[model samples]
Target: MIGAGSTVIFHFDIKLSDGSAAESTRVHNKPAKLQMGDGSLSPAFEAELSGMQAGDKKTFTLEPQDAYGMPNPDNIYYVDRSKFSLDAPAQVGMIIGFAMPDGSELPGLVREVVGDSVTIDFNHPLAGQTLTFNVEIVQVIN
Candidate 1:
């Protein structure tokens, strides 16, 4: 059984509320490892893993707040249109990387284009949506 400090390796398939597959670890043949009760996994997510052993499979759904939380309106920012490169003109649904003062890059999705301005959303794409997870526990490192 998985304990609070246990490390778990598993294969997961995540789907949106519409039943559309969002991501799957099986494609890369790489299993994901998570340390329980370390804040690495959400509380609800960890609860689902508790009492599970290797070779076990589980399917569960999470609400927006439980998964990625509701989208934050404050994460939206407007940038000058001139900032976009001609090689890759800004377009709706495009994810652009913006640099931070700390020398790190953050991804923002283009939401809309207006006169001399482009609205970008920095929220995680999966935010504000319900998600379903199908997980197969492969190993318990603990």
Candidate 2:
């Protein structure tokens, strides 16, 4: 069983409320290793792993607040079309990566493609929706 300070390797799949698979370690053919209580995983998500033994398979769902938090309307913004290259096509539902002031790359979804303006939302697509996780405990080291 796993406890505080234990090193563990597990495979997990995250799915959105609509049954779309958002991410999966199994798909990559790798397992994630992490130390318990190390701040790598959210406290709420980690709490679900407590007391789980090796070889255990579990599935659970979490609300938006417990997962990635609800989406904020303020995250949506309009950008001037001139900022994009004229050769680049602008279309709704496209995900564009933008560099942040901190040098981090943030992805924004294009919601509207007007004549000279584009509406983008920086919030995670999964935000504001319940998520389901399927996890399999592959290893546990104390």
Candidate 3:
């Protein structure tokens, strides 16, 4: 059975509320591996796979909060148009990389470009959407 400390290998297909495919491990023939109780997955997701054996296949749906959670209003920001260069104009629906203080880059989606002001959203693109997970357990090492 799958439980804490168990290393599980599984293939998954993620679908959006509209029944469109979002992601799938089976596409590349690469299953995902994760140790139970790890922070890699949300508590709700872990609970859904608490008890299972190899070859078990299940489909479950999760609300927005249980998945990526709702989008935070504070994640939206407005920057001066001058901050963007002519080479990469700030257009709506564009994903731009913003530098962080830790020397890493974060992706923010351009929402709007008003007069001398550009709006960007840093929330996950899938936030606030319901998701369906089709999972097949390939192996479970407890």
Top model number, TM-score:
1
lDDT of 2 at 36: 95
Model 3 vs. true fold: TM:
0.87
Candidate 3: the clashing residue pairs are none
TM for candidate 2 is 0.83
Total colliding residue pairs, candidate 2 = 0
Residue 135 of candidate 1: its Cα lDDT? 98
Task: Give each model a TM-score.
Answer: 0.92, 0.83, 0.87
lDDT at 29, model 1: 92
Candidate 2: residue 134 lDDT (0-100): 95
Judge candidate 1 at residue 100 and give its lDDT.
94
Error of 3 at 142 (Å): 3.0
RMSD of each: 1.4, 2.2, 1.8
| Model 1 per-residue lDDT tens digits across residues 79-130 | 9999988998899999998889999999999999988899999999999989
For model 3, residues 87-110, the per-residue Cα lDDT tens digits are 988999999999999999999999
Q: Which pairs clash in the backbone of model 1?
A: none
Which candidate achieves the best lDDT against the true structure?
Answer: 3
